[model samples]
Target: MRFAAALTAGAALIAAILSPETALAAEAHELPGAAMSLWWVLPFAGLLLCIATGPLLFHHAWEHHYGKIAAFWAALVIGPLAIAFGIPSATQAVLHALLTEYMSFIILLFALFTISGGIFVAGNIHGTPLVNAGLLLGGAVLASVIGTTGASMILIRPLIRANDNRRFNAHVVIFFIFLVSNIGGSLTPLGDPPLFVGFLRGVDFFWTTVHLLPETLFVAGVVLAVFLAIDIILHHREEGAPKIKDPTPDTKVRIRGLANIPLLAGVIAAILISAAWKPGVSFAFQGVSLELQNLVRDAAIMILAFTSLVVSPKEFRGANAFSWGPIAEVAKLFASIFICIVPVVAILRAGLDGALAPLVLLVSSPTGAPDNLAYFWLTGALSSFLDNAPTYLVFFELAGGDPQHLMTELASTLAAISAGAVFMGANTYVGNAPNFMVYAIARHRGIKMPSFFGYMAWSGAVLIPTFLLAGFLFFR
Candidate 1:
């Protein structure tokens, strides 16, 4: 997997240096999104649907062929696009997406996943309700610092170990997903992919911090309060039952692989530096412009991640039970998603003239103003099913792709979109990557994690009403 990531980075460098010019030209060719019909989006929808249903409907086939299924859907879009528009046009769009969007996205995820895997939280505490809540709260805070995936990977095993003796422990893991894996990631670009996508598109680094703080606090606080109440009740309920033995005895909690902490800091530093240091130098290939600072950021992050691998002990990684499978799956599936998103982005850019005009109107007020509440719900609804990053891009484009305007005049609208995308990703397991990863880790550690739909039932009963209150209170 290291070889694969290195090879990919090497290939990108090779491609950039080898053939610098092409018939695709320097300027981007615009696709006529307004001219396209609804059928153009079928492949995108197909891929998303397959992603949603594949695991449950056919676990064997999905586990084996999800990449192929994603490719098939992507090819459906790419093929017809080439025939409909000239090959150069299609090539330009897809290449731009790959070079500009997908490259940095996957690199950041890979770097974080690699670095976080090296840090082993090597002890556990007894699962008192207060202790469980403390861990969840601590993780929720840590998530904004080291990304949801990183935080989840670092803390989930310890969390599971803490709760192993508790009979009613699934709810703890579920709320962890709700808080740690989704809502907790709202404050920073380093926290989640959706916010990072916004950063790449020119959102200010502190924008979410300034704008979404109240909403994040409201939602997280409410959810935490609910968790405490339920956990207390469940803890009491377990008191009457025959005792279950604690497999992992509680010990003084210690963190192994302390070296990775600095590497994680390096990643955060790299992103901050990139945002601050715009050298105005860029490389152009097939009409895609790769900025110098972004290139340097990705390179620096990869280096830091690799450095963690070398610095951290092998036994620490084994103790952490780390594997590259989760990030690898994400890399493949998101590549296909980015390819499929080309025309959809074009359609969104067309605004009221496009096939998705109804969707646009649905999120708009009668006076044609952007409806903050509607933006919250609509972006959240799609985000709950499809991946939040792309779902964010969809609404970000819908709300007008200008980050400057979004930062000021329609700040609330952008806030709504951002809040929705980040917060509602907790609504289902498939909504965000770390949700399923945490579930998988818990189940492997012998915690009875709920089934996919059963997990949604948990979210539905808890999260939906919280979101509704938040939508009305903040967005309205």
Candidate 2:
């Protein structure tokens, strides 16, 4: 049923691409952000809070009826929007968020998940201190290449298996989320969604690579060093205690599903081609306008994902323990998130005239200059929970929304925003799609992973001080 829906959607999109320009009047159907009160954002806030507390507070109910909970929160926003803004206006807002924002976001993550899951690491190795660090480093590098989703999916099972013998291994997964899933993706747009959002908005592909290198190194280096130190102590402690039998101690480390490698490259090429091939052709669904290049890119990527399913052996995916549940969870939760974020984004678009004026004020100095330090912290803080991509977009516009200006003269501020959005996503489970996915995968493997707040405690202890020092060193 899901496959048929994907094909139908692809066929309709291709037909739309082939049809004559059907854009709906190229007019801005913007909500009145200035007039909307803070109360309008309650659904968004409430939904996020429920996401954080639901599992810990009511495990069985949340597990079974999370979708219903998500729908309830979405209705809270949608029902009110219809009452206050009229059905047409509210429908357009919700449709725009779903069709434009949520569609592409999920497609990217879905493609990465599908393709990478086929490329199984067939065996596990011992989790020595240096060995774990090496895996983290390798995954970090790969995150920028194939994206965080790809890197996490390809490496995580082996990582778990490697440490399955260890008594204390949850910290390993914690640092994996920090380094591989979030921090490592800073170097390229392919690495993280927020950077990709910037790219579509006209930021140069290499802009973040050049600007964020030093900051990326500083944070990655510090966290990695911390992981090494902790792993060493834990390794020594485990040696003194009775040894836990290694489950897969006999098999040697090897890579399977080699056929999927070129498909991964195809995914990258599709994204890059979309960026370069503008084509000046676009179609609209109601008020939302999507460019021709983007639609083609998505369809092509989905094709590649389908191709992986055809070519890769089912045994490889079985060995990796790949399942559709994690992506489904992400899809459902973020659908609610994107829907709830509509009014919040509208209010942000209102600038100083809106309810978040105090927040809008902080990113600037008293002299009306772009404060790099403030931009870093503010972008990072919001990104800790909110979708970093849109959070980055909001601040990108707040920083004047000019790609050339942001890339050149206001480079420091742009760097701060980019750094914050990419780096600080590690601060919470829901900060990026992959953060929660990685958490889900680890827990499903029987690792007693931390709760939402417990994960925050880890990030709060490790990431906060690192950001403070790095923020002062560079952005300040």
Q: Considering summed lDDT, which 10 consecutive residues are worst modelled in model 2?
A: 18-27
Best by TM-score: 2
lDDT of 1 by residue, 377-406 (tens): 988987886668877988998888899999
Residues 123-227, model 2: lDDT tens digits: 668899999999999999999998988899888989998999999999999999999999999999999999999998999988888999999999999999999
TM-score per prediction, in order, is 0.86, 0.93
Which sections of candidate 2 miss by over 4 Å? 1-28
- Per-residue lDDT for 125 in model 2? 84
Q: Which residue pairs overlap in candidate 1's backbone?
A: none
Worst 10 residues of 1 by lDDT: 18-27
